[model samples]
Target chain A: MTPQELRLACRDGSFTTNTSGYCAGYVQANLVILPKSWADEFFVFAQQNPKPCPIIGFSKTPGEPVIRVGGKDVDIRSDLPQYRVWRDGELAGEPADVSDVWQDDFVTFLIGCSFSFEEALLADGLEIRNITEQVNVPMFNTNIACEPTERFYGNQVVSMRPFKAADAIRMIQICSRFPNVHGAPVHLGDPSLIGIEDIQKPDYGDAVTVNEGELPVFTACGVTPQAVIKQAKPPVCITHSPGCMLVTDIPNSKLAIF
Target chain B: MTPQELRLACRDGSFTTNTSGYCAGYVQANLVILPKSWADEFFVFAQQNPKPCPIIGFSKTPGEPVIRVGGKDVDIRSDLPQYRVWRDGELAGEPADVSDVWQDDFVTFLIGCSFSFEEALLADGLEIRNITEQVNVPMFNTNIACEPTERFYGNQVVSMRPFKAADAIRMIQICSRFPNVHGAPVHLGDPSLIGIEDIQKPDYGDAVTVNEGELPVFTACGVTPQAVIKQAKPPVCITHSPGCMLVTDIPNSKLAIF
Candidate 1:
């Protein structure tokens, strides 16, 4: 289905599953809704740490539900498959629609997601290990610190994909073209160098097998913002439920710089 | 001095040393002059195996000394600092000028050298381990074979440089922009994976230090053509002596694709 159709289904409470593997060529994004007061500082934090929190689009005006930057008639309140409403940075509910709890001071941000670049890599014939194993991409907490703002600060989190050295090089080239979605990998080869203590034990997602000769290539992850927000203890914040992204009308190719 | 002046010095029998650091920011090529009989097949070989044998320019007509593609008034016979004269695949002599042995049926091919990309990497503030340690970049014969023509067939030869993982990623991005200069690295991390038994002992150049936390990144080298030509055993073949290259008027920046 077209992104508008899919989003309409979501708005009507008919689509509540993970958005992965839907609308093959379209861009999907991680959602972030914050109070206008916290959002300004969050914007600075995102701009400062783009690899983990690249902002692709956002609400033009606070409390306005329409998001024209990413698509036509994208409502920030109910267009996504699911959202996690937070109170004091603690999960308050996983709701199919947020119109009930939506605040007048809310500012919605659409952050670039890895799904776009993953489509690019798969199109280029590179195997994504997580996709092959039918699991979430492995993610880890690294000692690599993010550039911080007064209201948001935390270490960078990274998602892992294992590839042979040559394939890893090709992967780097492909990902570099889509900077909005984490760009090139932040690190590859030794995980310990980035303070990822165990390659097989990820902090956030299920660990996929790292073959004998394959290197675990790490890209900055969107989960970084969630982790940072939790640490900052924002009074009210909202984010997409894991894998239940906001599918957009924008084609994945639109994200490629080259 | 300009490349023309440098070529004139070589022509007048005044410059007889290596051209490694000379004519900065200009292209320096690995020279290969072959009899017209062997040139055709070698051209096909170079075209098929561009990573190791990227041909930047060649003689417009057989026996012509002037190379117009890369520079003005480039006399292949004496434009390089020194030339190695080969007879039946064996090194017959190393001379400052080949005027005494210039063959009318000779066709010269200028292969892209790593110096162009090294200059690029250094300009971007990336340290080249070979330049820092003051030695030749280590080269190895890999199991990765080149696509061959009838007369030219051999495994690829690669030059090694050590870099931390992040620097290697940056180096890959920088080098990818200059495909004429061997493009991105062929393999990185493991030497034995490419058939090199020992990282400390290279088949062709001096071995530099591979410090802790550094990967030995490998790029296909110009030496592969020389190795192939030697194995092909042409009646007469001419090449630049080690570290002596044919300096051209083309700026190194001209090689960048984007």
Candidate 2:
């Protein structure tokens, strides 16, 4: 389906769940909307740390509902299927549409997500464990710290896939081509080193099987910005409810810097 | 210096040592010349395995001194600083020039070498340990087997460097750009996994100090082909003397596919 068609369904509340497996070949983004007071610090946070928080689209001025980078009528407030409203570092509600509560001071952000690299990996014939198991990619909270802005500070979050030694090398190469989509893996083998005490238990997403002789490869994840923003505790923040993404018209190939 | 000028110097016997650290921005190649009887099998072997033995230039016809891909006036017999004459796997002699032994059925193969990526790493401000220590890069034989032809079969040979985990990741990404030049590392950490019994006792080159927290990163070495050639024990095989490469006018940047 086209991004516009998907957005139209989302706007009318007909599509109200995960954006995965929809709008194939197009870019899918993580949505972040914050009050103007906190947007500047978040931008600085993304600049200081790009791999985890690659900003693909952003609102130019406060109260701007449309993000032209994706479409002429891309309304951040109503395009996504679900929105997570956070108040003072806590989840206030999970709303399908935030237009009723939208404020004039809101600024939208669309950060690049792993869906782009996942597409690239699949194209290369590499098996992404989470996809094979028919579950969301397992994500972990890691000990690797992100370069912080004064207000935004937190440990990095990484997604994992299991591959044997040789496949891990190939996965690294394929993913490296899409820098906007978290680039190469942050760590491989020995989850403890990255501070993930248990490979079987993920903080987010379903845990997939890691077969014998396979190493779990970890990449910087989209959940990082969400985790960081929560710790910062801005007065009011809105982000895509988990797995609900802003599907854009851009093809995944466009993300390749080469 | 221009490739033509450098060739003129080598032909005149003014340049008779390792061709590295000179011809700053150009590609340096590993030379392998074999009689026509063995050339076809070796070509298949190289094709079967590109990462360890990427062929950058090859003679179109056997016994042709002309290397068409390298340059218009390039002569295989005299451009390299030194040549090693191997007689049934034994080093028969080392000569400054091989024009006397040049035959109508001899084919020249210019395989990619690691010097290109070392130059790239240095340009990226990553310290190449061997260059920093002013010593030869340490090399070892690994359990990883090369795809063997009828007569050519042996364990893989790898060159080693030490880097912290983060720098190792960066090195992998950088080296990946130049596939012809050994490409990215074959393995990192736990030498026993790849059958390198001791990191300190490399089969070739002097072992430098691997810092306490640094991991030993291994890359498929150009020496693998040479090692295979040695094991095959061909009646008449020739190679560039170690460190004495066939410097081409092709810039290292041209090797980067991206």
**Top-scoring candidate (DockQ):** 1
Candidate 2 Cα deviation (angstroms), residue A55: 0.8
lDDT of 1 by residue, A18-88 (tens): 99999999999999999999999999999999999999998868999999976888887899989999999
Going through the candidates in order, what is the number of backbone clashes in each? Answer: 0, 1
> What pairs collide in candidate 2?
B63-B104
**Could you give candidate 1's per-residue lDDT for residues B1-258 as a string of tens digits?**
999999999999898899989989999999999999999999999999988999999996998888898588888888888889999999999988888898889999999999999999999999999899999999999999999888899999999999998899889999989999999899888788889999999998898999999988999999999999999999999999999999999999999988
Off by over 4 Å in 1: none
TM-score of 2: 0.92
Per residue, candidate 2 scores C-alpha lDDT tens digits across B17-117 of 88878889888899999999999999999988787899998998999897978864888898889999999999999998999988889999999999899
DockQ for the candidates, in order: 0.71, 0.39
Q: Largest lDDT belongs to which candidate?
A: 1
Q: Residues A77-111, candidate 2, lDDT per residue (tens digit)?
A: 88999999999989999998999889999999989
Model 2 has an lDDT value of 0.89
